[model samples]
Target: MASSSSPPEEQYGTESTDNYETTCWGCGLRVMLPSGASIFKCGWCGAITNQNKKKREQKCFGWRVLRDRCFLSSVIIFMLFVIFGGVWAVYPIVFSISLLWGIFHSIITTILSIATVSFFSLAAFRCAGTPPNILWGSYPTVGQGDLENYTFCLYCSKPKSPRAHHCRSCGKCILDMDHHCPFIGNCVGAANHYSFVCFLISAVLSTIYVSIMSVYASLHIWPSLSYSLGRLKGMTGRDLAWRLMNEILIAFLRSTLFLSSRGLLLAYLFIASVSLQIGLSVLLWQQLSFIYQGKTYLSNLSSHADNEEEKKDCQNLVRFFGFQHPVSRFFSNFRVTQKRHDT
Candidate 1:
C-alpha cells in the first residue's frame, strides 16, 4: 500500500522548514505546523494525527451486533417453507411416479437443498465478517486539502482509501463498497460479494426445482378430484357452484387434518416456490448486471466513470472460487468473485 503519511525530509527537502505546511490526513486542508510539533489533531476534520501508527483502534460492532434480526427471522421462515411445503410434501409424489424417477428426483433435490443451505450460511458469515481496514496516516500531518477521489471519514477518523466509502449502518469505512443489502443485513463489498451471489443463485435453483416437482404433483391431484366429482349429475347453476365450493372445502380440510392430499400440499408449495423464484431472479439479474459493468452497486448509482481497476469475467471467477489452474476459469460463469480478505 502507498504511504499516506507526511513526506520524509529526504523527499520534502527544504520544503520541511519551520514554515512548512502539509494537508490534513483526514480532510485535505492546508494546516501550518509549529516547530517541533509531533502529535496534533486536525482542527477541521477532527482526525487525530499520529506519525508512529498508521491505523488507530476504533470500536467496531461485529455481525451479531449489527445484524437486522427481522431480516434474519424472515429468512428462517422462508427456509421452513422450502423444507416443509416444497421438499417434504413433494417426496412421496415423486416416488409414486416411478422407482427410477423417485431415486433421481431424490438425489437432485437433496443436492440442491444442501447447496442452498451451504451458500446461505456462507453468505451470512460473510455479511457479519469484519470489513477492510480503514486508511489511517502513519504520521501527524497538516491538511493540504482533500485529494481527488478521496474523502475523510469522521466516524473512523481516517483517510478513506481509494474505492472505499463510509457505511453509516456499519459505522465504519468499507473498501470497494457495493451496497448495503437489507436481505443480508450488511454491506456487500469486495470481501463478501461472491458469497452473496452464490446464495442468490442457489436459492433460485432450489426454488425452481421444487416448483417443477410441485407442478408434477399438482397434475396427479386433478385425476383424483375428477373421479370424486364424477358422481355429480347435471344440476342448476347455483347447485353446481355449491357442490364445487363444498368439494374444495372438503379437500382443504382433508389435506390440513390428515396431510393426505398431494394436491393441496403441491398447491401451497407451487405458490410459495414461484413467489420466491421471481424475487430471487430479479436480485440475481441486478447483481450480474453490476458484475458485467465492472462496477459496484454504489457506482451504478452515479454516472461518473469508475476509477477502480476492472477485472475480466474469467479473472473474477478465479478470484471468487480461488481457482489455481486455467481449466477452472471455464467455470467462471457459475461463480462470483470475493476479496481474499473476506475469506
Candidate 2:
C-alpha cells in the first residue's frame, strides 16, 4: 500500500492503471487537455457555470459595468493613425493630412463620445424607471398566527420595509435612492437606478476620457492647422501659396484618412452623437416626470417613507408602480421588496 502522504499519481506524472483523464469541473465529462497543457477547460458546461457564477456575482455586486464605448472609439482613432502609415511623415503632405485627420477624428470622436454617453444615460433611465423590487403597499398577507411586527411610514403613511426611503427631491417615499445625479442627468430612484447611474457614470467618465484623448491626439498629430484664419505674415507670394497649399493638404489628411470605409466612419459618428444626446434627453425627461409625480430616488424606492398630505395617495402609487414594474417581480428573490420604503 502507498504511504498516506504520497503525492497523487498525476502530480508525479506516474503511470496509473486507473482511469485518469482531464475532466470538466462543471460536468463529469472526460475531455483531453489542449496540447502541452496540464488542464482542460470545459467548453459547454463550464461556460454555463461561469455564466451562472457571473450572474451570482452580479447579484452580490450591484451590476457588471460594460467596457467603455469611448475606449473602443479611442482604439478606432488610433487604428486610423496607423492606417495613414507615416504618410504624414512628409511635411509637404502634412498640411492636407493634418486637416483631414482633424475633421475625421473630431467627427468620429464626437460621435463615439455621444454614443458612450448615451449608453450610460439609457442604463440610468432603465434603472430609475423600473427598479429592482416591487412591493405593493397593499396589505401584506397577514394571518392570525403571523407575529410579524410592522412599522408605519411617515412619508407614504404605509407599513415601512427594511430598505425603504423618503425622497426629498420628489417629496414622496423612495425604496432605495442612491443619490440624485446631474450627470446621467437624473435622480436615481429605487428601481433600475443603480444600473442607470452605473451606466451614466461609466459613460460620462468614458466620454470625458475619450474627449480628452481625442484632444491630445489632435494636438500631437496636427497642432496648428485646426485653427488658422489666413496666410502667414511676412511671407512672399510664393511662400503664401506654399503655406496655403500646406494647410489644404493637412486639412484633407486630417479629414479623410482612416482604417476602414471613410463614409461608414462618418455615418457611425453621426449616429453615435445622436444616440448619446437622446439618452441624456430621456434622463432629463425622467427628472420632470418624477418631480411632477413628486418623487426622488429615495422616495421612489419605497412608498411608505413619506408621510405628507398625500401620503396615502403616494403609497398607492408606489404599490401600483412597484407591482406593475417589469423589474420588480424579477428582483423579488433578492429581497428588493417595496417594504423598504419608509413613510
Candidate 3:
C-alpha cells in the first residue's frame, strides 16, 4: 500500500510506480521513483544518481588536443630562441664590459634557465592529481558514506569526487583542478599547481634578468641621440615631459636605421621580456591570492555562487606549502608541557 499524501518522486524500493524503476550505479540495486524524479541518492550506499546527466560526445576533442600541442610547441620554440639568441647577441657586449661581470652573468643565466625549464617541464608533463579509486557498484562492497558527496562521471564512467572537476580538454577528472593551461598543454591541479607557481616565479625572474641585460647591451652599442633640444631648453613640467618623450621617440626611430642585427635583436628581446614580465607577474599575484584565500579558481567561483564567505588567512598559505603540521607540532609540544606544569 502507498501513502496517499507522499510525493511520487520521494517513494523508494524496487516496486515500480508507473514503470519508473531505475538501478543505482553504486549499489547495483533497483529502486523505484516517479517518472519526474531525475536526481536521487542511494540510501544504502549514499551514491548520488542524476538520471539527467549523460555522456557528452566531444566533437572537437582532437582539435583541442592539436591546439594545445601547437601552443606548447610554440612556447618551447620561443624559449629556446630567447636563450640562444640572447647568449649570442648580448654576450659579446657583456664580455667586453669585463671578464668578471661576464662570468657572473653567465652563472646567473645558467641557474635561471635551468630552474625555469625544470619547473616548466615538471608542471607541463606531470599528472594533475587523479582521484583515488573507491569500491562501488555493489551494496556488499560499498559501505555507507564510502562515496559521500560523489557523483557519477558520465565522461569517465566512474565516481567523481566532490573536489574533482572534469576537464574536457584533458579528457579526465582532475582532483582540485585549478584550470587548464594551453601554454603548458596540461591541467593545473593539486599535483602540479605548486610546480606551475614555481615556474611562473622562475620565468618572471628570468625575464627581468633578460630585460636588464638586453638594456645593458643595447645601451653599450646604441648610437648617440641627435636630439635638437636647443629650442625647448626653457620648457617645464608637462610641456617638458611631452617634448622629451617626442624627442626620444624621434631619436630612437632615427637610431634604429643604423642598428646592427644584434642590436635589433636586443631591442626586440627587451620589449618581449618586459611584456612577458608584466603578464606573468599579474598571473603569479592572482595565484598567490587564491592560495592565501584557501580556494582554487573554480572553487572561488562556486563559493561566490553559494554566497559563502572566504576564509582569508595566512595559515592557508602556510598549510598549502605543507609546513603547517611540523610547525604546529613544535609549538603544541611546548604548550602541552607548560599546561602540565601549571596543573
lDDT of 3 by residue, 247-323 (tens): 98999899999999999999999999999999999999999999998888898777453576768998888877778
Per-residue alpha-carbon lDDT of candidate 2 for residues 228-252, written as tens digits (9 for 90 to 100):
6365777778888888788878775
Total clashing residue pairs per candidate?
A: 14, 61, 0
Better of 1 and 2 by TM-score: 1
Judge candidate 1 against the unseen true structure and give its global Cα lDDT, from 0 to 1: 0.65
Q: Considering TM-score, where higher is better, how would the candidates rank from best to worst?
A: 3, 1, 2
TM-score head-to-head 2 vs 3, winner = 3
Residue-level lDDT tens digits of model 1 in 1-343: 1122334442321233464466556654455666566555554434545444444444455544446556866886778666766656777767776889889987887788777777766666564334344434433343333333344555666566557777766676777788877666677777777878888998898888888888887666544322258745786699988987888777755545543566667777888889989999998988887776577788877556555556547555554556666675545633544433355
Please report how far candidate 1 places residue 35 from its true position, in Å: 23
Full-model lDDT for every candidate: 0.65, 0.42, 0.87
Task: Please give the range of 10 consecutive residues that has the lowest summed lDDT in model 2.
Answer: 47-56
Task: TM-score for candidate 3, please give it.
Answer: 0.85
Best by lDDT: 3
In candidate 2, stretches whose alpha carbon ends up further than 4 angstroms from where it belongs are: 1-111, 123-141, 144-150, 182-185, 208-214, 217-343
TM-score per prediction, in order, is 0.63, 0.29, 0.85
Q: Point out the higher-scoring one by lDDT: 2 or 3.
A: 3
